[model samples]
Target: MIMKATGIVRRIDDLGRVVIPKEIRRTMRIREGDPLEIYTDREGEVILKKYSPIGELSEFANEYAESLQQATGHVVCISDKDNIIAVVGASKKEYMGKKIGKELEKIIEEKKTIMVDQNADGKIFNILEEQEGDSSYLSQVIAPIVSQGDTIGSVVLLSKESQVKMGDVEKKLAETAANFLGKQMEQ
Candidate 1:
């Protein structure tokens, strides 16, 4: 059976019991007795996640990327284990789930730079000034969605050289993303 990002068939009965697909359970490290957390986004996006920091952050980053694309006209790229796992608000899939081991991946590896680690709480925002191809500095905001001393993933906000700002609304949204991640990591 092929795994899809969406379109997992589920039916909720009157008693409210939902069956999770075996594939999802296995990939998320969810055992028979393992705990799961459910969350609803502002757009009423319902999601079920494992109680691991990695799992929660992954979910938060994906959604946050979508939100950033909506608010700003920049492409949001999310990576995990040096692989670009998801791409949001971009015209083309520049680096979706692409394993970063050769060029860019090497740079990230050498930096040993972690935007936010696990146990990151509240609205923590950091702006990184990255040198662009034109020898200009472009700022990007990276916020990690953390829970239970683990970092599931991160939210990346991209903007032009002069338009990058981690404002109040962006900070709150990042916090909410983290909260959602935390809730998912709960039992």
Candidate 2:
């Protein structure tokens, strides 16, 4: 674990509350009501991690991604709001655990489904911001997972082959997977 000291400190009040700096909150994407997991190590260090409900289903997501990859013959990625949690297919190593790009974040925020292919304006988007100019997929379908009226994650189908045109079938499959995952969260 690489830790960087921000050179900022705060003292706890009588109520046992120490305000987290605004800069850190923004950088970590921690909103007002977001849940945070606090951990203390034997080394006397305290760690705060943003909690993601979808992250609790990591194993289930991996199985879902594998099944989707087999059924669609393409790469399948299941991501929480901030990072790709599960990925299956040849590009799994490249995308797994990576922070998703801004475009995908917008899609999830909008709670919409989108398909991109050679014939559909050719607007290829990076799955990860770090992969800005290195996107290898020729087609993609993205669907947002909305649980209990809250958009939590997404399911994506990606193909590297130029001949694999993503159409209604792929769109529906992604949407179905996203819906299934969302329903799982409800339980």
lDDT of each: 0.50, 0.88
Across residues 1-187, which tens digit of lDDT does each residue of candidate 1 receive? 2335757888998999988888877555456755567887797777775443343356565776687677766556655433455567653344564443333333333432223222233222222223123212244445554556544444455544454554556555545654564556565
Which regions of candidate 1 deviate over 4 angstroms?
1-64, 99-137, 161-164
Q: Give the Å shift of residue 45 in candidate 2.
A: 3.2
Cα deviation at 57, candidate 2, in Å, is 0.8
The count of backbone overlaps in candidate 1 is 4
Name every residue pair that clashes in candidate 2: none
Worst 10 residues of 1 by lDDT: 126-135
Segments in model 2 whose C-alpha atoms lie over 4 Å from true places = none
List model 2 lDDT by residue over 42-64, tens digit each: 99999999888899999999999
In model 1, what lDDT does residue 32 have? 70
User: What's the count of clashing pairs in each model shown?
Assistant: 4, 0
lDDT of 1: 0.50
Best-fitting candidate, scored by lDDT = 2
